[model samples]
Target: MSDKKFELSRRNALIGLGTVGLASAGAGVGTSAYFSDEESFEDNTLTAGELDLFVDYWTGANSEAIDGGTTGSGQNDGGVSAQYVLNDVKPGDSGKLVFCPKIVDNPAWLWAGSSGFTQYENDLTEPEAEVDDTGGDPGAGNGELADNIQVTVAYCEPSDDLEGSDPSGPEDFETVRELNNPEDYTLTDLLLELQYGYLLDGYVEEGGEWVPTDDGAYPASPDSDTQTGPCICIEWNVPTTVGNVIQSDSVEFDLGFYAEQERHNENPTSPYATGTTDDLYPPFDSNRALGMSIQGSGGSGSAEAEIHNATSGNTAFPFGNANDDSDNFPADQDVDFTATLDVDSNTASLEVLGSQAGGTDVTASDTDVTDGQGDGNALGSDTEWQNGGIPQTVDVAISARSLNSDTTTVKNLTLNGTSVSPDQLAASAGPEQTYLVLQGIDSSAGNTIEIDGTLNIEGDASGWSGIDGLVINWR
Candidate 1:
């Protein structure tokens, strides 16, 4: 309530890339002030007020000697750097560490009706204090540091994780606190606070159907007399295509476990402004973004597939996240070609359905076509051809590896035992980088292809890549 923020920092905590670091633990206390003014009769005597809130944590691994004791498993050096080390990390990687924060025997108090009333009761509830309720209102009244301690996490650059530096500096802290709670109190709230707080970026494709379901993630809150044990498990994932531009990019942070006296409610109008101003301190905020970063491997080799639209190995396919419905060709040239290949009978059929400027639509079938896994021998779908092209069917075998690649070549395309459009085959194969985007495999079909004007392909649905529902159906 005092609007005061207590920040703790760690310097050079090394969490290596692609590895999880041990849990870090540390603690500190917030202070309170008492003022007594004598405006009474001659024989009036007074004593000083008392208030002390202390908090400390024990890392899952080691216990150290801080406030004197024999040097145990580790050194209780104090501050964040003494707790744990977070090293190099990348996207899609996660790490965890557990620790507990407990309130030792400490003194706490709250002001009654007015500021400085000095009529102290047992704890916060005993007094049942009142707030102004006008322009600014003090939050709900609860006694002890249990209700007053405000904890928040801030993001910064690794270079800024310094000693004695103001971790709250605007330049150093990210404005948006990623750790947030949902609008309502659902099972997700418990799951987020207890298990997935480390997921700074919410649920991605990585978390397959990880919807929130209550299974005892968050325990009950601690009362004034008891100490609550909450674990802070920090995690990071390295992306598959991490390269030069992304290399060495680090995200530094400061987890400020702040505590302020509820006395602010007493001064309702002035300095004792009740409650914390930091948005990250709100209740049920496990969804708050964890300030983190993933370093790049600095390796190279074209992390993307090449889309060839024409010969000369140039004229790359102009495919984008959206469909280019505007680019419609008018007249049809000698562009009508079609072929149907029957793998079982080793027979083929060729027909010119229509005319087109480019290669005609082609359909390929292989009795042995499968997901390249155990599910074998199914009907193959037809290849989609763009730009006023007629459909052509071919009998051949296609593998999953070739489908996932950026570029694939259908060499020596033949019709009636003669080469048809060899150059066009290369172009089609190249642009079909994610050509393997399929839905569930049909009983008779090897793989259900998702393409424009096809049942498998949803014209309006969108996928993560901005492409239209082109999900890779990996068996």
Candidate 2:
């Protein structure tokens, strides 16, 4: 029936702004402690034992170096720190932290939780763009690092040296124990799991989810005159296979500790419900693009491409992987693309297929073909792509440079599965960025677009021919 907290005040190990530094906090209200003697009975009523909690912390990185905590001296300062922080972390880098709790009075039920989970993409990198969740886009998307970093937490006994510093790994500790069969959760998933506070050993995995145990979290031991208290050691690392997608990302959160009176508390539940990433990455994602497969059938030239979105430029229109490619076609790739430009009828055709990530066959409901690739979507779970991201149609420009001798020509332009000829399209010098507007397209079978044109290269003409560009953008 009381409303006061006998819990240990929280010391934040915050994640900083820019590069996502591990900033641990330990300073709290400076109220001194009051302990009771081993007395059997008091005046008229039985005296309840005191149960105030305190904390001591330690951190380690790749070199197993101490980042300043209760490290050197044999005394526990009760989690005092100017800034127990670690910066300049990299991939394949693994580290551990021990947040030891002390009752300073009596043993009690302990709980652990996290809050203020924030993340930001900050800057965009190509490797990251390739594997990001469906909804994230540079600057306006979730961060990648936290989701890529995997963590494992366990209960442990401090090292024999009491130095609390491990040069090799947690194995140097006296004993490294687990809470049931704990899974190696990514930092992102772990944050969600700890939102409302986990009852520590008091929580168990039932069926498939983690829930509060019947008897509640186990009563963890507190510090004594001769030994340190049971420790909650968290070890985390970025896997080598995760690639460079998480570069230049940042994440922040607060690791908190709580305690309740075990003498009466049953089915303990935490009130801490703060689990939102400042800017974290979605676990699964994809991009808005012109999905296609190119196949050639009888011709002298090729127009092969599956890269590029709705807004690609004319230069990359027919082949490049999006107009943004620095080295287009045969330059960035090692293989040759093949598509036929009919030599007899002088006609060339290309058919491309479209279907959003996890989209089905539009075989019948082919009404309004989605106009543009909307803001990058969280494709899988969301199960839908919104329209109006980039323009649905592009201005297929055709400009050319010709030497003396003969001439190479392009005519009878067909776009978006329709035949629309302008200026008779019949050109001996290749039109200069011609503007042609085609209205209403058939979006059946997932918006399949077919482009057909006539090509006439006369007298070994001293000229070149190819699609100019797509003229849209990169999602």
Candidate 3:
């Protein structure tokens, strides 16, 4: 028979932080594809292709851990079980299926340390305290009195097809899906969508009693006629190894007193109550029905080509329909395909190239410097200096201002041992006498000129002194 195609959606999309690679095209990886044709998928219905089944387990509000126990405290710890049956297809042809449970609205309240009774009493009014000891307080030297409970479902591939014969024993026929740690699994809000069915009604066995009322609570007697519903109870120890599937045996939960008390409070006139007297009220009952269905799509036109893990080659694997049906298969159709890791030399080189572009490098530097000064003599004017024997010349200007008086003038100015007056200068100045040294002047033009490295000026009549100067070189 021709292979079929399919597309699977994630059930708990936001719960985990891991990436699930698609099987390769010869082996699909990192992609979700669908089939385009409908005819091919229908034609391959009877073909021996793989089948994928997803099973979900659901629990009612009362099924969660009540007060401090693993089951409810008030009513019988009765729960319901449900089964979702699907067509048996081949192993590889089926699409991915995910099962999730509904989130509990009213979680079980926990009582810490040895104060279970004290905590319970604190939560209730005086009249409600009458039934406090029905379940035996955890502090009363009785073992921990747990009022909370939980229901879970396990999934396994059946040894024998629903209709086929099996030589394997019952043990061999069942594959156990262990659910030892309820805390590790994802709890969803989807369980509310399931259709409930009854498996065990309100039946609390001996020594399996719980408090049933806030006032004068007592051990719950088995009631075949009690309003019952279905619930799936998972065993704490489920097998991890895969094999054939088996039907689970009836399990027990401690339906503590609160469930029955709440139920009684809801319907004071319930038939299960002892008297019609309004003040003499009975405890409440819990709803236990549970069911769920997960739908998906498939077809041959939608078959995904993936890389094979062992052969390292591309191959087609059947992913179910867009709408999760096993009957439809479209032939010779265009389907999406993805490639898996084929780390050849070229691929490795590309990866290395990508890394190189994002890297950085650091290094050191090189250069030089020179310093020289000539004719160390004190000068009262700005002057120019030049390298010996160089035709290039440098110019300098100097001036002094009077602080006490508004008028100021230059006293003496010199450059390279040559005396020069402010009047001999060419540059313009303010009210003060300033000297401007012309660099291109005769023999002095090529002479190196220097000062005490400082020019200090004192004003005469004004008794004020201010110095301002500028030096310049020209090549």
Predicted structure with the largest TM-score when compared to the true one: 2
Deviating ranges (above 4 Å) for candidate 2: 1-48, 63-84, 126-141, 160-175, 180-184, 202-229, 273-475
lDDT tens per residue, model 2, 77-180? 32323133444455676776666555545334565665435565655556555665433433422565666677877777656575755334344554355532
Which has the better TM-score: candidate 2, or candidate 3? 2
Instruction: Write the residue-wise lDDT of candidate 3 on 252-348 in tens digits.
Output: 1111111212222432211211111332222211121000000011012221211110011121223342233331112212221111111111010
- Against the reference, the lDDT scores of all candidates come to 0.21, 0.37, 0.20
Q: Give each model a TM-score.
A: 0.22, 0.41, 0.14
lDDT comparing candidate 3 with the true structure: 0.20
lDDT of 1 by residue, 75-171 (tens): 1122323233333323233332222222222211211010110001122221123321111111211111111112233221212244535322122
Q: What value of lDDT does candidate 1 attain over all alpha carbons?
A: 0.21
Q: Which residue runs of candidate 1 sit more than 4 Å off their true CA positions?
A: 1-83, 87-93, 105-226, 229-232, 263-475
Better of 1 and 2 by lDDT: 2
User: Model 3, which residues run further than 4 Å from truth?
Assistant: 1-200, 204-234, 237-475
